[model samples]
Target: MSDSNTPDPNTSGAPVPPRPPLPDSGATGHPAPSTPGQAESGTPQPGNGWFAHAPQTAQHPQAAQHPQTAGHHAAGASFSAQPTDTHASRTTDAKVGSGKIVAVLVAAAIVGAVSGLGGAAIGNDMFAANGTSVVSQGSTTVTVNDPDTVNQTTGIAAKTLPSVVTISATSSSGGGTGSGVVLSSDGYVVTNTHVVTLDGASSDVALRVTTSDGKVYDATVVGTDPIYDLAVIKLTDATGLTPITFADSSKLNVGDTTVAVGAPLGLSNTVTTGIVSALNRSIQIASSAVPDSGEQQQDQGQNGESPFQFDFGQGQQGGSSSSGTISIAVIQTDAAINPGNSGGALVDDKGDLIGINVAIATAGGGSSSSSEAGSIGVGFSIPANIVKRVTDEIIADGSATHGLLGAMVGNAADAQDSDIAGALISDVTSGGAAAQAGLKSGDVVTEFDGVPVRDATDLTAQVRALAAGAKASLVYVRDGKTLSADVTLGELTE
Candidate 1:
């Protein structure tokens, strides 16, 4: 129960067991300026499980244990950041993990900091003054003319910040703070599950939410989808709150302008800018970082607050080793996401919510964890499409369902079939969707549901992003011949 800034490793993401390293993508990027680093921010909380096929599910036991290399993985290492609080002491917080050439899909609580970030933006003129001020009276009234023009970044901040809020969690175990996006005017909001649950340390944790306009409200967990590491909370008696606009993440492209709004390192309403560094990235990390395996119902949270939704026990999910390694498809950005940025908004140029900020890639390998978690220009976010889908289901039934491919897969690169880049099928579950579609051993999946399949990680992530029983098409190659099939996905099982 120490301050969340420097997390408590044992409570958050305990060290992961040894496994084979993911293949390096040779990813590279300019390091975030050292002016504000993750060193002092806090430990990890959704994580680099010390830590992607981070929803990394495949029928193969070995594939579930070890994910293949992601061509889109960042250069160097991956780590998780936990949310930090405003507490003066950051001692003994969450754990921030790292992996060579992979982002540790560490749960939230292994957060990073954004100290001096606003100053850096000011220096870069990102938050430039509206216009020069005119001085008329020294003591009485000062004359200031309106700005002739507003920069895109400045306008974006003005438009989006009000919809974002700072979330503080409290319990006997010290409290933490993370960011969230207001989804409805009546106070339904979305954030990372790690932020709400203190990276799974205490389900009984209480939450206090503060909006950009200085409004505070007690909130309760409506429901949580730990498989995707996302959660929904409702502000008590809240009304007239600004709801964020959602963008079609499937339509996004690399290099598009991205603005991240969150409370990074407890810095509320903090805004940072960068480009969509990459897209359709399948990052696989240990599932332990994001536990609960399925949907969780809330009976109560934070002082007599009634739970928002009734748990019917209708939605239960697990496919990736019952909390082993999992793979997730994320949008990569250089927008300076720190530990506390979990559950925050990654918006497009138009202030539309395109993704939810999640994890940052710290510099470390499988051997040891980063000293702390922060931004390194390599940050990850859950796509807006998934956010919308999961949030809708949570709001409707207090739970969500994820699609399953029900196949054992490995990297096509491992098969040395250089002719095509895809997920090489080793085995297909009997009576499973894949098997019903005529998929079998020795088949290479070239595409799924119209999305290209680069490897097992990609396939696993795409499958988990959708719901069970969804009909989708697939393309594969067998014996150097391309094949196609229409398949109905199955429900993921523990």
Candidate 2:
């Protein structure tokens, strides 16, 4: 319900000694981070490797590390066998309803909705009817010719696996595993910013992507929307890639089937299944560390290295920081998301893209360490509709725009004697859209654009999901009377 949103595991909680940097193979796994200013444990960390599961020592690795780990891992024999898993999948049939209010890290739900991309959104033809796309103009994107009907869970998994990828990001700081979805032919991939940037640990990241076909390729970040926790990266000289089919998430209903595909715990080609637990669920969390210049640094990694942070060396970093808090809307599902599943795909029964996996709701709260972060049948994703809008803008313009209500608002529940759940307009910017529409302080917004407005979080998430200059209808309460009005939204500038 708050910022306790547990970002999917950076580590599977399996504590293995850090492996040495393999040539052309990304940064080797490093032992889990110890307490502040302490040596990392090379010995196995008992009973903490994964969330309610055993670590696949052969596949899972301690992802994301601090820079001070320069000398932590010894270079010698391999840490574990580097076997490739092409068609690996196991079912974890768990489900949770959207009404379940569980404590979770809120990173995934922070970004609610956004609708622009304007001229840039023109190429949605790339994702054609029934999840098929025409040949991309400048690159080769292989699609499943008349893919099999996905009536069952296995069918969904099989249809979508090839389009999901296991991303290994390493930096001089450390390295860890996450997930991504193929967006275009020219090797454009959509993933969580935390995955490539290791939860904003470092800006300098080198990425190594392993597709479901067990093919590995190097990639670079095309752009990132940290406020939304979404990022687009492009593969280098990539071809024959199977593009994912897009589903209209706004048309989805509760109880529809969902299948999540990713590399959870660093296990590649992993799949889990669930249903659409809820919609328009808004969340807020601390903002990611973005460069003041608002520009993404190009790949500065050396050949055969990852952009993830693994402190195999002793290089130390001081206290880290981010910008501030951000609000977002998300899709809630129970498809067993894990630490490494960030930026992966959460598809529907037709194997169509619906949402991109991000964070999970855990029961308890403590430190930021994901060593024990596991899904409690409550996970969050960026809805495909929003993902499409933000990614399209990022690919075309290197950033995305969000709608502004031009009003300062708060949760109505905070008002004494208030008996409703909605967003209370505390102040309206003069000459702003809301003010021009006659909205004033003390008005409680109950609905926006036909969607229910539960609170300020919900209102903000809803407004930000649309394009600036977009027009919308809203119902609000004033002086015990209900009123409706049409208002054009404004642009949110950072």
Candidate 3:
């Protein structure tokens, strides 16, 4: 089996401090300015700068007050009458002010050397000081330098990237790949359900999760919801997992920094950066909006009569409710998303997940059998706020249900042409709340609790917002007259 460990190391960051320089010996046979202090003898001293005095030696007040040294005292030796070169030269140099100048110059040189060393050390370039050895083990490394490298943001990307996994699923007919964020140490992973189609593989679906080290593991689908299109999966023997951090998606706005990390086009861990293109964009899935007429009808030319009859049951029938548009609200982003990128994370600048990439608008029309269903700029993600609701329901009950009104309604445009206004109910469930409230299939629901409903979509949205078993007053248009009735909503069952 391949090692599941991640071997990538943290990138180089801040610098290190410089090392202290080696002390040099002076020609006069004296320790090179041990510290910044005055000489021990009671003779007048020449050099009087900050660095001129040896800090290690005791200060002589009389010598400091005087401007010159009368004689030279070597280690346990005193110079006599006929002076040696050291004593004669010292006397002449001290008298000419050369002794103090030379001492000050040497002190400055030492300080400069120390400063340069410190700079190189802090610069984080271990090679700058001298080519030192680097010790590394399992994604961690240490480099020896003259000083040390202090990092504030190191280890973050390395720690988080490994936890980010690439997911691929295969079925009998086709396969898909995406990315997922590990949500638990025991192997719970969150990804897009569209990445792994149901395909009757509820228990037999094969999944492969690849870590940063190129190691692959067999994974299993935990549960998924087609409504939200989010799925959770697990792998065996998983531990020490790093879960992704979540950000408040409601607080995000257009122009915010959006960074997508996913396996775009099967390229694992591919990262792309962009901004939120548009918020609350309405997108429609053709399959969801237009149902197939199970029975194919012969071409009837431009009579505009669709073979299938759409029954609007507590939901909006396909018609331009307003502004000639028909689709559910969605979040639009410009971040690069591909067919394989579904279920990957759309994160903020701080690395917090904001959304899950779901679908991209196709180019022209029809589906391509090629492997490259990549983003052409426009991409849509299921809003986290909505996904949260769907996920909660799916986890608790294994399915999501909408509020049911028990009335069969038709599209506003078709009803308008038929001289009907509001929701034209074609049928009502027997013994249902509407039937018990003295309502019939021909009644047109025009309002609810005095709130005017322009079309079925607005009514469904408002009614679905209410919890099941809630009482609502319904107003309908019957034979050019307005009427009202109180009815309790029913639980929607799949």
Candidate 4:
């Protein structure tokens, strides 16, 4: 695989995608000065605005083929330094009256450089004891002391980099590289299921993981949950590894600082910084499937349950009936998520994992064969709460079980248009959780597990967030009467 930093000749001709709109609340400072042929020092420069660096390749392995849909696979983009005009130069003259001016200029230069001004100004008084003409047209280099302040991006990267890893998977069909996060010291890693499996097949896939220290180890699949787009893999021989900490994603708020770490476009250990752009976004992408004589066939779990479903608006079904699609409630961020960033960590300011960087919204609309563009700042990640719940189930058993309400719920938009305040039950499965709980058709589910159910999508997201067999209380309105009942959630079946 090619390194992500390397430029690609193929993509050189492609048009640069438009950037997503950024919030106007942040400080609008001047850009930092450019230092050609120099390496980044990870210092937070004043006016060092963020931008999405296009990946070398547009071929994201998980990118969706359908452009008309909202959920499309996207890769992570690297964040690189851009030129700015924040740095300024000062000149000192060898005059009797210029001593105070020179001292003030030097002090200002030092302060500016330390505060992310990107450069420093020096006077000739320090170099020469006697009054000598030091001011010249030639350029002079100034050195400044490193600031004591800590950069949040650098700090988060330092704390979590060891726990992140690069995952390379090869199968008879094809091979690609992605990222993963360590879950246990003995080598249990969590990644997107698509990272380890082929497009259409699960078996016969070979997996390997490369840690931050440059050690490579063979790995095997422990379990996979395509419905949630997550998987667990174990290294053949791993020990004493640092595992990442999970944060409470439910408490996240918009504008909270976020850092995304992954191997974008095969460039390992890349980090990008941004804020939580939004929350509770529902996205649906095409499910992983193999082509059968030009027809797509959805992959089923061991229990024969289809792992994906489409959420067509107004409760109308869309897409191929035989094929399935995965719908998820995601955390949105402006962090540069590109191809190869799939299954990577989206951490908060404290270095705790809050989400898994998954798909990016591209200007090209993405295709099944290849990504048409890189990140546009609209990146989505699976919330850590869902990750924690689903991964726990996968680790406990070889498979994951989702909680099911066993009812056909009306679309939230439809309910709103019809003046309904909750999830309207269009039908209830016989002997299912709803039926057993005394819920009947035409009942509107007002609340689930103490959380308000604004619509069908809200209810679906809440149910998926729960574990199978968990006890929950449901409040619904039946025949214009409000009622409440305690129900034991049933495991979703094929």
Candidate 5:
């Protein structure tokens, strides 16, 4: 089924109006240029006081010398409490109390005429509310409502969202939808691993991919790296595809415009734009437990668990804050990303893919509650460079492998506690490379392949950058002894 470009109320509706704008608030609520010149209403305008003098009429030259009337209001001005235009020149010659009475009558009559005119214009429809007539196309329309600005993005969206796909995976419990981008003409698609992971085995996992055109394809998982929240699936015999162009994420700077395209809040093919709020931000995927928040409660149904897990055989205890940890840099933006946006591409103004939209920060602890699951102007994405490296590894092999040292490194501040300024061997896998090479717990590997190691995160990144089966020399301090060991790197397995 082709996803319609029509906006969804939850994802693309007009924002709720704040309190009415008062002149004293110092904030202007002026509509954009396309709106009518000014808002019309039936009320007394400024400069109609008893002592206020009317401008000498150049249009009415003959009446310029005549004193203005107390019962009359300026032309085009209407008051709910005044009389009609017939009392145009009621002067102060009348008794003070009588002048006030006539003024009130004139004001009421003018207001009645204005109301009658307004009612006719609206066809006497009491439901002619301001927001009812307008429809929001996306975030741009919600904010500016300018045709040029709204149309500026629609063309690109029309061509792109069709190629975007929604993925669903089923296990013993159930399944959910996540967004994906087409990767090849041969029907290969890429998305987040958690979206298609099987609780037991791949054989038990029922994976389905649906294009925006409503065509559903049965997919076979090609490879996955849950550590990076990425997965690839092959759609049989698919052709005539449009692959997204990848941009250099490193070139992206703060404040650069970006568009987030995905099926957020179950609204397919939704598009939102915002600037790169920050770059190279560090976010921890401590746990998969989503909070009991508004929309999330519906998305997460029951078990307060993540749809996926990051248990890579460190034996660090699954679900621990440290188990699913990927200590790396990420890009942060204000672009709205909701439930299904995970794994979708974060593209630049030119429509080139830059990053993979990922985890959002939740607002609570395990037993806490939340109000919304949609983007709160704080969304994060993995850099494209990292995605390229991991994807390449998975495509070349059936799975991904990262070079590893036998030790886990900590920050510099934490390293001082043990006087080991290198990758610290927290625990060693029995018969693994480090154990076989005489590297032991409490020993810190300070250098790798001639490069100095700073902390655990830096070490993990450097090691992952290297291919498995490579020879690396490590410099470590053991019980105050500086020792060197040569060990062949091993692939990190889950």
Candidate 6:
């Protein structure tokens, strides 16, 4: 189910407010471009935002933003819940044959042949007709092999099903169902933060996890990183449980076999198979946040705020002005991940967990209404590498930290217009990592560590992949000369 606040794609009856000009950077002399695809004049140009050459007056419908909340509830009811039909019946017929007549006939023939020898044989035929007869019986045995063979889909499912669990979240307002992956034998399970939070609020929500073996246990939220759309939960009294093996997501390639195991539409232990469609995909989804104590305010940024100012196209519609939402990097897959599949396992051919199945794109678009939809071959999963890093920190410290570059970067089109092929730095935070590395506002970041920074989004994703406080080598263009710098990353703070 998509987020209730997501906008519908078919209707264009309402006019969107005109976007404001990009914020001016003081002392830097460079203003951020308005749209990633066009210049400051708002003219249509070839770029990444939406329409690659749409007229300034032309208003294109926004792409539907699906939140991938599989267990979304509506007004105290489950959106994916349905009445289950369990009554089934079968009929069989049996056939019987009479052997008495056959036995009597055989005795009569023997007696007739023996009658020539003795009259006593004739009396035996009459006795056989009135006496009990011998019956013949046959038996046959069949052997069936187990279907869960190694290297097959069934094998993957069998190996991973024990670690994949169904999650149920309820509140006084409503309840819903999703899925989770066991991260530890002592009850640590990883899932989307939205799965347990109520309407993006962490308070007043109750969570429970049901294992594949039909065991249910109450769960407590250990910690959640809303920016990553990941949360860690602990199952009460859980021990000796099976945990999934995490594969190196960095080793995954396109066309590698992927198997998704989850409970779609409340169906437990369901498995779907496909191949890795793409990687390093950035998607925007709504996130819930609780206000600080005694804080009373409204109209926080619609797209929310990120420590590393990473902007991806237009902000998705459907979030309230006060509600916080953020974009996250994900692994794209053609696997049939659907509503109720959130927090499930996306495993590789060897049954090792590569990603956590999260949101799925749908054809119907997203709305604030109470309708639910299925996947359209475009599903996104949180890479297992990030999952491991974030969950480990949560398990130890009750919160997770992300690496930040402390610079406001421009989009790809801005770089192209500047005749550069890297991320353009429009502003650098005072005393931040970028400033400490001698990076000025006009400098264009070309490379970080060893990976090329193609655009602002690309740079943000790479920084997030690393741990805070790690050292990184950066190459940038200042004036007409290129320079390199070694700097320590900064930690993101809320």
- Indicate whether candidate 2 or candidate 5 has the larger lDDT: 2
User: Which residue pairs clash within candidate 6?
Assistant: 4-368, 5-318, 70-340, 200-288
Give the TM-scores of the predictions, in the order they appear.
0.65, 0.65, 0.49, 0.64, 0.53, 0.63
Error (Å) of candidate 4 at residue 102 is 34
lDDT by residue for model 2 (1-494), tens = 12122222234655645544434424545443343211232211121111110001011122223111111110000011121232232211111121111111110111000011121121221112233322121121223233232113333454556667777777776566667787765578887766666556667888788877677899898787766767888889998665666777787665555777776666666667776677778765443444332211110101122222211111222114444445567877766766566677887645667787765553433122444445567777777888888888888888877777788787787789899889888788899889989999999999998888878777877887787898999999999999999999888776
lDDT by candidate, in order shown: 0.55, 0.56, 0.43, 0.55, 0.46, 0.55
lDDT (10s digit) by residue, model 5, range 1-494 = 11112222224355634434335333566542311211143221111100100000000010111111000000000001111244343221212221111121122222233331232321221111222322221111112122222232332343345446666555554344556667766676666554554211223456666666567788887777655556677786677655655667767656555667766544556677776776635443432222222321111112223221111110001121222334334567777655556656676544556676665543332111224323456667666666666666666676665665544444533655765455566666677677878987677667665656655554564555455776777787788888888888776554
lDDT of 3 by residue, 1-494 (tens): 11122211122333423334545555456554422122232111121100000000000011111101100000000001111122112111211111111111111122222221233332232122223333221222223333244111111222224445766555553343456666656666666544444211223457777764466778876666433345666777776655555556666656555556555545555556566676644343322212122110110001221111110101101122111111223456676665445556665544455666655554433232233233566766655555455544544565444445776555444554556546567677787767878888677787764455545544554454344577899898777788898988776442
Winner by TM-score between candidate 5 and candidate 3: 5
Model 3 score (lDDT):
0.43
Which stretches of candidate 5 lie above 4 Å from their native place?
1-152, 198-203, 286-329, 365-368, 415-462, 465-490
Report the Cα lDDT for residue 317, model 6: 22
**How close is each model in CA RMSD to the real structure?**
18.2, 20.0, 29.5, 15.0, 25.2, 24.5
lDDT of 1 by residue, 192-263 (tens): 665665544457768788887677899999887767777888999998776767777888756556778776
Better of 2 and 4 by lDDT: 2
Which structure is stronger by TM-score: 1 or 4? Answer: 1
Runs in model 1 deviating more than 4 A are 1-146, 289-323, 366-373, 416-419
